[model samples]
Target: MPTGRALEDARSMLLETGRRILAAEGTGGLTSRSVTDRAGVAKGVLHRHFADFDAYLAALVTDDAARIRSIEPRSAGSTVDAVTDVVEQVFTPTTRALVALVISRDEVRRRVRSPGSYGIPLLMDATAVVMDVLAAGREVGWIRRDADVAALALALIGSAHLLYAGELGAFPDHSATHEVVESILVGSL
Candidate 1:
């Protein structure tokens, strides 16, 4: 029955609570009841905003994907550094869990995935961001002109995801992220 700002706050509260649950306990701990309890909202509030839990999850993943797309790769240093920055931004605990949630649930994956697009939701968007960085590097002579940016982007994203996704709650440090980026781009640059 909240009106105006309270109504908006209710949805934001639900989403934020869901994200915290995902970060702390992964997708296994997230449920409609859990979200409602954590957000201090009634169960019907979630249903009122979203069709079901899957739809709410889709919104969450989609919201995160948009964030990934908005990240502007750092261009101040080496191409590796730029790519590393973007990877770091994309590989946070919440994002990592969102990626897992997308992979673990078939319906949520389908709902978040764009038509005709193939790849995991958040990771795929991160790859595109890295590809843009690599393309810029190529343009500026930092990367080899003949390098296959698509493959390189994929390699970087997949390898970094493995490195970051290996441990939940604890993210890899900058050195580890740099190592992954440098190793993948060593030959291409």
Candidate 2:
């Protein structure tokens, strides 16, 4: 059996391979065999670290959430710019694929909704960040005072999710999506 450091390294390697596969082919192209074969690990390595495929997926999504959380805005930007940066991060290829995979698989969706779900914590944190930015924008008269911040945040999330799902990784240009979201957020400005 692999020792402590080796075990962690192995798990990380498997997860990275899984992430790449997911990004390239969506969930439909991912499996334990595929990950293990691509990762050059024993077939049972993934099972040793996770209870099952769903567990592996949950861990993967949690890893992604941590990465997303690290993309904090610098102090040099307007609230609208900051918000647009965050939205762009969500629409990145890997993130989009991961979210699309989670939504398509019933078992993975259930796992992500369970107690202590990583998705919930990430989402709550993101929503709070958006709300804070919106409030700040309102204080500065950047965002209209009557703008519904919470609804706006939800709309952003929904639009990005739908864009990823509808395109299936083939969206060559999201200028239209960006334009729409930008208009919605700063239309009155």
Candidate 3:
């Protein structure tokens, strides 16, 4: 039990370290030694927490996803409010990594192909909020009665990626981002 707990604790620490490295030094700074140094753990401790570097990176992404979810407000009143919450939450390290993953052509291919990446609940929670809000909107007749809620949820999530995806290509200005999100919500409603 002690060993298992330690491994779990180390995994959490490494993920936290990964976020700090990304913020402080960008993606290139995410070395195992850096993670150990940031985590204040010995090198082998990081290794013991995961199979290898790829495992660590994947875990970092997962951890950031959780961090993103933590910032999502429970009952945002409006679609714009929801969008604001998402944008603010994603500005964090995990959100940056997620944006990075989708923007980079190579990482995009890998993430889209790998279903496991979405297995983390953090990303899913964002989607869940969309669903929840839409469901509430439906109850109040603020959304379409015959709407495809899941599809709308997916669309909202996709728009978030487009607005926040700094890695894919140069994005338009804030007006573009706001218009895109508002357009999606309007379409659904």
Top candidate when judged by lDDT against the true structure:
1
**Candidate 3 on 85-107: residue-level lDDT in tens?**
56545555445554454444354
Clashes of each: 0, 0, 2
User: If both were scored by TM-score, which would come out higher, candidate 1 or candidate 3?
Assistant: 1
Candidate 2 has which clashing residue pairs, if any? Answer: none
> lDDT ranking from best to worst?
1, 2, 3
Clashing pairs for predicted structure model 3, backbone only: 103-167, 103-168
Regions more than 4 Å wrong, model 1 = 1-8
| lDDT agreement with native, every candidate | 0.89, 0.70, 0.63
lDDT tens digits by residue: candidate 1, 73-185: 65558899999999998987789989988988999999988999999899999999989999999999998999999999999999998898865678888999999899999
How well does each candidate superpose onto the true structure, as a TM-score? 0.94, 0.78, 0.67
TM-score of 3: 0.67
**CA lDDT, candidate 1, residue 182:** 97
Question: Which has the higher lDDT value, candidate number 1 or candidate number 2?
Answer: 1
List the candidate 2 regions with Cα displacement exceeding 4 Å. 1-8, 74-77, 114-128, 166-168, 172-174
Error of 2 at 79 (Å): 3.8
